[model samples]
Every structure is written in C-alpha cells, then in structure tokens.
Target: MWFFIQAALYDNNITFSTLGPPKFIDRQEVPNVPLNAPKPVIGLDASTKVATDAFDDLEPEMIYLPLSAYSHYRLRGRSQNYPLLYEYFDINPYSGKLETSRRVSDLSMLEIVTGSMRPLHTGDFVGLSLKLVYFFFGILLSMMIFSGMMIWTKRTYKSTQTLLSRSTKAPSKTTKPEPSV
Candidate 1:
C-alpha cells in the first residue's frame, strides 16, 4: 500500500529506483515518539455542532481516550482541516494506544497526498495539476448542462409561439370570396 510504502521508505528517508540505488539519512539525535490515547467528545453533538466545533475556535481539542477512530474527535484551530492542516490522535480499540498521528516532522507524504485530495497551492506539483484538471472538467460539465438547458428552453419557446400563432388568426373576409364566383 502507498501508506505503508510511504511510512516505511519516505518517512524513514530511504529512496529507491531513482537517482540513488538506496539513500539513507542519519539523524543527529534519536527521535522520540509520543503516547496519546483516544478520547470522546466533551460537548454537545449535532451536524453543525460537530463540523463547526472542529473549525470554529482555537481550542486544545480533547484526546478521545476511550473511542475508536470511526468516532475519534480532535479539537482543531479555526478553519483548520484535519487531514491536511493539523495533527490527529486516534486510540486503537485493541491496543488502547495512540495509533495514528499526522506527519509532524516532514511534509513530503502529507503534501503528496492531501495536495491531490484537496488542491491547495502549497501541495505537490503533480497533485495540484490533477486537482486543477478535475476542476476544469467540472466547470466544463456545468457549462455543458447549462447550454443544453438553454437550447431546450429556446426550442420550447419557439414551439409555443408557433402553436399560438396558428390558434389566433384573423377571420377571412366572407364577402370578398363571393366576388370571385
């Protein structure tokens, strides 16, 4: 999977099949990993409540300590998006330990992915191109539909005008026809 491949090689700085056969980077110091467990929602629940709460204010969102990723909750900054902007904490149901977190050190993997999923100017170049292409096609589709509707409407209007003209004609002069006989 790309996720594992990214985590194993890219995150660890092991590149292959490119400029180098196998590239490795040594850390000046060892890294430390955090221990975060999932938590539940601390406040009210609703459609707007859930979505708005995440992006409304600068809150140190609670760690859902006893929930699964499906219902995982992370407090976010104002207008912050989870998959791209902020780090997340999700507790594994079986392990009861923090399982998934966003990229904290490097920007390659996250930028590579979210760039395509969402086309921000600051993402991977190819991904950004893909998103732009998708948007262009979407606009094209909308224009196609609107033009088709306009054509249909014009045809209908012309047909209605012809029918009305046929129904509302001036009466022929009866006396003028008798002169011919």
Candidate 2:
C-alpha cells in the first residue's frame, strides 16, 4: 500500500542528546591555564588533593545513560594526548566504580570516539515490535467480530422465513376437499 511504503521509507527523525562537557572555545582563554583544563573541583584543594570532609556534602550531577566505552570522554593531558576518562566520576548513579573505570580506561586506551551516535539499542526494537504486534492483533480481532455478527444475523433471518412458510402451508393441506362438493 502507498501508506505502508511511505511509513517504511520515512525518516524517523530521531533525536539524540549528549551529556558531555561543552566544546572548548580557545586554548589561551585563561591566563596560566593549560590548553587542556583540569578536572572539575570536587571538593579538592589547590594541590589537586581532595579537601577535608569533601564527600560529606557531595552534590552529585544528573546522568541518564549507563557509563560505557561509548560514553567515556576525555581531554588531552599533560605529556599525553588525552587524559583518562576515569579521572572523573561516572555521572550515572547506577554504574559500579570498577565497571565505570574499566569502560573509561578501555575507551581512552583504544582512542575510541563515542557520542550519541551509538546505534539504536535492543529496547527500541522491543518497543516497536510490541506496538506493531498489538496493532495487528487489534485489527484482526475487530474484523473477525464484525464478520461473525453479520453471518449470525443472516442465518437468523433464514430460519424465521422457513418457520413462517411451514405454519402457513399446514392449514391449506387440512381443508382439502370442501370446494369440490
């Protein structure tokens, strides 16, 4: 059908969102600052050491996706092309520390660039499949009910006509010879 062809070939117009830091504008924006900025100060002092009681009032950032090699991001480090993504905490709350670190390290070591372009996942497939299955089943059920009702009404009308004919013909058979005399 024309509708099906259009639906199958139509652009889904999928929207993708990224949780990483914004792009850096310039290298010499700040005086005495390296081109690659340091990690966010998470209760750390000037010596790059964690400050006392820093975690007592930890305000975590909001993260939606699971931490993975695809989500690991980094900047160029001192004497290195890019700092390890594990230098920062995984923004995802559900991620285990070891798993998060491992994913970050794997991405950084292999120099893989990851972003929102990761292919649509299993959840998307499952959801679409369910929607289509339910839609077809609903259409089939509606058609079946409609055809069944039509057939039932037709059979009922034929039965009523047969009953009326039998009752009317029985009386004519009993009054046979009265007109002959």
> Which candidate wins on TM-score?
1
The digit string of per-residue lDDT tens for model 2 on 55-157 reads 2222222223323323322211111222212123332111221122223233432223322112121122234676577678779999999999999999999
The residue pairs in collision within model 1 are 38-64, 38-65, 39-63, 39-64, 39-65, 40-64
Best by lDDT: 1
Give me the overall lDDT of model 2: 0.36
**lDDT, residue 44, model 1:** 31
Q: How good is model 1 by TM-score?
A: 0.29
* Candidate 2: Cα lDDT at 113: 34
Q: Provide the clash count, candidate 1.
A: 6
Q: 36-151 in candidate 1: lDDT tens per residue?
A: 73332243333224444443432333443333334433333222333334443333333233333333233465553633343344342234676677678789999999999999
Structure candidate 2, residue pairs in collision: none
Which 10-residue span in candidate 2 carries the lowest summed lDDT?
43-52
